[model samples]
Target: MPLFSNVPALRLTLAYAFHDPSSLLPHQTIPTLLSLPLPLGPSLPSLDGTGRKPTIRALVLDKDNTLCPPETAKLHQAYINKIEKVKECTEFSHSAHSILIVSNTAGSSPAPEHEAEAKQLELELGLPVLRQHPDRKKPFCGPDILKYFKDHGVTDNPREIVVVGDRLATDVLLAREMGSWSIWCRNGWRNPAMPGRDYRGFFSKTESRFERIMTRGFGNTAPLPKAT
Candidate 1:
């Protein structure tokens, strides 16, 4: 993966995150997406206590680390039970399009190689994950994502979608850009081979460390969405 492939995204993230470090914070943080409260129909009242409620209608998930181990196209063994539990919920099982895995690697390009990765992930997870054009990568791809949700009958409102990922620069920043909710996976899947170990790589670990340092003292409150 090229470090500077998405210069625009990096620039946007740096500007907003530095201007308001809180923008880098997520509405919530969890070990994994499946750890979210089930049924997934309830409204998340604003933390600012203005009675603002954003009901989630769709989910935008990151593939690497957030789902499986970093760079893998399959689910972590430790997440298998969680996946089974999530499947029981009507929100996920209702429609294949309700949840999407928007990985920067697998599906964020027009290349056939990326398309193949997307297909493999969909097959492994039994979900309707799709590929994206190179310009449609996260943070820069927020509008394209919203359009996808609308086209798929998920929801036209950006506030109704939530982005879940392990990265602050990409995932959380993407949600902030979209005026949507976000959930940061503080700890990704546990390594099945090594119990009690986080499944991550050196690059991911270093990036996460940098993110923490950059967003220190920030409150984990999502930015309020614009009125429809």
Candidate 2:
């Protein structure tokens, strides 16, 4: 039996599921669910961008909040520190990994300020900026990232790439579709009301959930699985 054979019925029920919100409850307060931190066993060694891991060859990152805080007041210094940290992490590992910045700045013809920002980021991070135009409805969803890797001659399977970003809708969704692992930086900007609102939490919670789900089917120590 194929999966989703009962999907049609499920969809029918879901379509009218929200027709009567009042019928569900009367001023019911949902209990605040707090996620407990899991112990990082000694078996799980520290990951500092090095280590001969069996997976994740490339690191694709989002610039805005994942790398640096989004505060205009301290963006410059924060960015510089982020760059240094990235360099240190990558160099310490001594792994021949490629770093790419996938960002949503202006479109092809970015404003003067946007251009300047991109240039600054590029210089600081020592990586090329793959800025997607805002007008491009699905900026990251389009073939921008895939085309990037192809153009750069990255023939490895999508599973070999890891995407780190702040937003779940953009970064996580794109990674899922492309079959790439994703690291959601909890300190960045995010939308908590979306479908996966549960994911928006303290860094510890997000990291713990991510580790739990990814390690489920794979071996215990397997590098986190790509989000789907």
Candidate 3:
């Protein structure tokens, strides 16, 4: 049986909810309209690069939630620790892959806040950051991310690349759209139901459940498929 038993029913209801001309909550319903499912295509093995193995030559990381904990609005000393963790966990050998940051921040019209954060991240992580507008159109990962890797001579093999982020709406969805794997860090942002004193709050079980539903329903539109 399919995981979402009521897929067709839900889709029909959502279609009526969104497209019915006389619907009362059109505005509220429109935002929930689902896109066509993106095919998972074929599976690629791990990018360790043995023989004809797929070459994953870049790692795109999200800043606020994936690498650095989100509680601190701006960069802080704790970021250094996160940077270290990224370096240690990611495959960053001189030959195979490079790491870059992809993120969004808010501020004035032009949003120098994201730029400043990128600069701080560069200093802390000792790597370049690729920033994109929050409202990136289709090809949601942004062209610059691809350009950054191209300019640096990074390989284009999807198996060799991975994107890590906290928000499925932005990071995971974007990565999946770009045909790259994604890792969702369960250490940032929390729904009210999972409130706690420290870092545990953001890593709530409720958030996990929601993410699971969204990810499964959305196919590869998630950061990391549920482990096996």
Cα TM-score of candidate 1: 0.83
Q: Give the clashing residue pairs of candidate 3, or none.
A: 56-160, 56-161
Candidate 2 ranges beyond 4 A from true positions: 1-54, 71-82, 88-97, 106-109, 133-139, 189-228
Give the better candidate number (2 or 3) by lDDT. 3
- lDDT digits (tens) for residues 1-228 of candidate 2: 011232442242233224421111111111110110111111122334456333444556665544543422123444455455554553223342356766654222366766676677666556666666554322234366666666766535675565666544445444554666555554453223432434233433443354445345432432333333
Per-residue lDDT tens digits for candidate 3, residues 148-181, read: 6767777555545666555444454445546666
- Which candidate number maximizes lDDT? 1
Clashing pairs in 1: none
| Candidate 1 residue runs with Cα over 4 Å from true position | 1-5, 41-43, 47-53, 192-220
Candidate 2: the clashing residue pairs are: 107-133, 181-226
Evaluate model 3: give its TM-score: 0.56
Each prediction's TM-score versus the true structure: 0.83, 0.51, 0.56
lDDT of 1: 0.71
